[model samples]
Target: MCEKCETGVEILTRNGEGRRNFLRGGAAVAAAPLAAAGFSGSRAAAQPSDALAQSEVQAWAARDTDGTFAPYTITRREARPKDVVIDIMYSSICHSDIHTYKGDWGMPNFPLVPGHEMVGRVVGVGSEVTKFREGDIAGVGTMVDSCGECVNCLADREQNCLNGTTFTYDSPDQVSGGVTYGGYSKRIVVTEDFVLRIPPGVDLAGFAPLLCAGITTFSPINHWDLKPGQRYGVIGMGGLGHLAVKLGAAKGAEVVVFTTSQDKLEDARSFGASEAYLWSDEEGLRSQMASFDLMLSTVPVAYPMQQFLNMLKLDKTLVNVGALFPVEGAHGMMMGFGRQSLAGSMTGGIAETQRVIDFAAHHGVAATYEMITPDQIGEACERVVNRQARYRYVIDMTAA
Candidate 1:
């Protein structure tokens, strides 16, 4: 669920010192008056990018720090060498988008179009681009660029670029001129290296969230070397958790789901969980003590760490794929006593992200999403904020 879309924003805004400036810093360039950036403000018009040519495109944007989304126009850079111009077809809303848009991560680049889980058809490619071509289906995730020479990038982990990574939106784009705008627009220009090739038969809309949710869960399972026939526990049944259920089951693990909602038990079982237990069921929770070899948590808010830590076997791990908010009663003794480990993971790097896409396609796994038209942005945002959507909410750009 997108429960974090609302509550997480409140938490971060209250606790984070630099959050209010999220829009201020990026807004300076994004919301600048005409003369400051050499614009006339008459109508959306093409302008020079940091490259050869650029075009202003139609998009939905939040004009202020309040994050009320509406129709607005933004510009996208023209394709340069190693760049791919994509006509975005679908964009899935992630909780991070909510946090960023609401200035929880600090004020975002105002006039901001927030989206990172994007899938599209390529319309143009630069001279030096070899990874993708025109007419091919491609996808872009949370990041758009990173210093290729960095150690992490060299290791195929661009998400952790030592020199700092460029996010798909709200970051300075040296090559594009203004702060990066995401896929809420009709088109986006990204370097070929950062773009992903979608498999021929995958469902584009259902597959879009994999760019973020899929890779996030897959990276840790892959990193921990989850072997076949091992016991795996998935906590939470939201977007990330649902995918984790499928991926863990696909890996041949005896997957279990730990959720507070009894209604989701059927969904969890259908997603391949061998068993589902309610978190509030003390008897059910107690029966699983020191049982799982590994546990992956996708809960979007701050949760009791010790209870989850207790689920791990000796030397086992409980990996968190959700919010990094402060935990109220986290004590090292939980892990220290059992030799268990607690860790956190972010979205995966490029290679691992692609692996997730291909693997998911092979396993016939994808997000169960609610499709919304452009005009429904406000309602969609509210639905996600209230956790009322089925699982994920995807913007259908082609809808009228």
Candidate 2:
């Protein structure tokens, strides 16, 4: 039986009575009874504040492999008994979004809506949903759902679910019968188990990137057991690297930044990095040899793995949070010499993601970002590929 059957049936019966009474009383019928049962204002909208209908959600989509974004209208799924409908307020452009949009990662579903860093307000809930209510702030990150019965999922590591995991966009949808449309839309319907509650006091726009970049960096830190006073080196000063600096510093680590561009030094330091060094500096690289306890490489392109391996102290580890491409011919002896290790990680599970959000808020940490509108998606994506964005770019849907 559905968990909320008793309450749900009661509500549905009252709704039936409401319709009958409305038919009898004509235009004179009061909406008080329907409102009390959770369905009143706006047809099918869970909350009175929602301005969108499930079928009228506007989105920016790439209709072909050309990767040009344009306005599109897509229908959202009807809210299920255990689902929540969100009216999207903001969506951040992640590097992965650009890659997927351009087909660099692979051929994505045409007419793709690419965005995972989503922030919005709950506008509707399923009858069985008790976690969220209308008018509450909410956020959605990379993966939307997984096989709940998988061993990894039971361990709270749903990202590594033994069964296939479902991503926010370009993923097959079992319910809606098409590839899932993502946060680059007016609204989305997600299961209650996958939606995260947004805490008060976080700048909603600034907090959006945390749903992706923040969790990407934070997961590795916690997985590797980063501790206060440990020397941590963050390679690359892009989206993931910038967050690593702030989160590592917040953990009381002596954070250093390794970058290819000399100009990013100030930007790195401003993000709470203790020092920034050009990775190209031979003398500087050698001087820091075997000094770091943990180093996170966020550079999306492959570089000299041996050089980074040389920076770790005995029994230390270097974790990669960026760059899905494989490194070519990295010398294993470098790590073997010092008993060091190299590893890779994706975003954290749902619980860990929530913990990262709360932890970042507690530290007053947020990604530095520039805001753009849906019309600017093409240019915004170009800037990210060109490494021209200051830190991150967020699509302000409120301005749409």
Candidate 3:
């Protein structure tokens, strides 16, 4: 359900620190912009990137403390025996990108190329790599690497490995001798181990967010063991909730949603919610308490703890997929009564991410996205921060 689009409330977005900029439309073109840097954007990201053959590759980079992103040229590493170079097509905008760009999460590495939900084709792969080669469609999500030999890595959960995971962007990668840059660039060089094959025929523009938003929502549902005929609830109607609705509905579970706007009622229904309730309708919500088997929250802001706790049935769980914020106090006895547990999840692991891809392929699930160009990235982030986007926003890297 595209609530923001339906209500004529195009999510409000402030400009690049007061500079007014509207999003560029259509698919990611990876077309080089006329920036001084002579960049060709995501086009240069294909595997075994042949930058030497191309005149330029365009990319968005945060070169200054002023906070506006500018176009620049990216030089791709030559393909090595284990290397797979991808030319980014589209990059999904996630809340974490907002935090990183705004310098809210921590001090960002300047010239920070902000993006991670990347989709592109394999333009080049080293001879040693059999999984991918020129023209293999793929995606790179939240993780890029782990130390590979830890107990957790051996268990196929690199994200939980004792050796801290190597994140796709904005984290340590001593091997690179620099903080890892992300998919906002026209191209990226990764080991074949980190690349994922994207299912064919899906809308590449809409499919961008599935790398992050899709996996984020699907993990908890699968982990929680949501089965056919089960009752589940999704809180909030933004990016995560919308996908949760479709996935839950596709899973044969009856999905109920709690939204802030009565305007979203019908839209939520389209996402497969058997029922929808406005959060402001306290009386109605209170009347039907403790009934959901799983209450999955996608809201990033704080909410009254006790009110939502009442919605869970015995042994039910409320899974938080959003970031940590200040939550209010509630009585331990209330949760103790039902043995209801509140848990949160980060991004999915590599293997689980693969499962998410297969699930989306089998179920025909994808994200509802607004495609923007590199020039519009700063604006897009501002829109997402201000809650003004229609579900999700993906940077059309091809337009860089």
What are the per-residue Cα lDDT tens digits for candidate 2 across 58-147? 999987665699999888977778787887888998888877877877888888999999888777777777666676677899988888
TM-scores of the candidates are 0.85, 0.87, 0.84
Clashes counted in candidate 2 amount to: 0
For model 2, the superposed segments whose C-alpha errors exceed 4 Å read: 1-53
Whole-model lDDT per candidate: 0.77, 0.78, 0.71
**TM-score for candidate 2, residues paired by index:** 0.87
Q: Model 1: clashing residue pairs?
A: 1-238, 19-106, 22-106, 22-107, 22-108, 23-107, 23-108
Against the true structure, whose TM-score is highest?
2
Q: Candidate 3's residue-wise lDDT over 1-400, tens digit each? A: 3332222212222232110111111111121111102322324332233432332456787765445888867654455676677778888888877677667666888877767789876676777766654655678988887877877765456677687887878777646467777888877777766676676566666777777788888788777777777789888888777888887887778899888866778988987888899988878788659888887888876676667777888888888887567556555888898687888887776666765765676678788878888888778777777677778888876666
By summed lDDT, the worst window of 10 consecutive residues in model 1 runs over 5-14
Order of quality (TM-score): 2, 1, 3
lDDT of 2 at 379: 86
Q: Quick one: ranking by lDDT, best first?
A: 2, 1, 3
Give the lDDT of residue 70 in candidate 3.
88
TM-score quality measure for candidate 3? 0.84
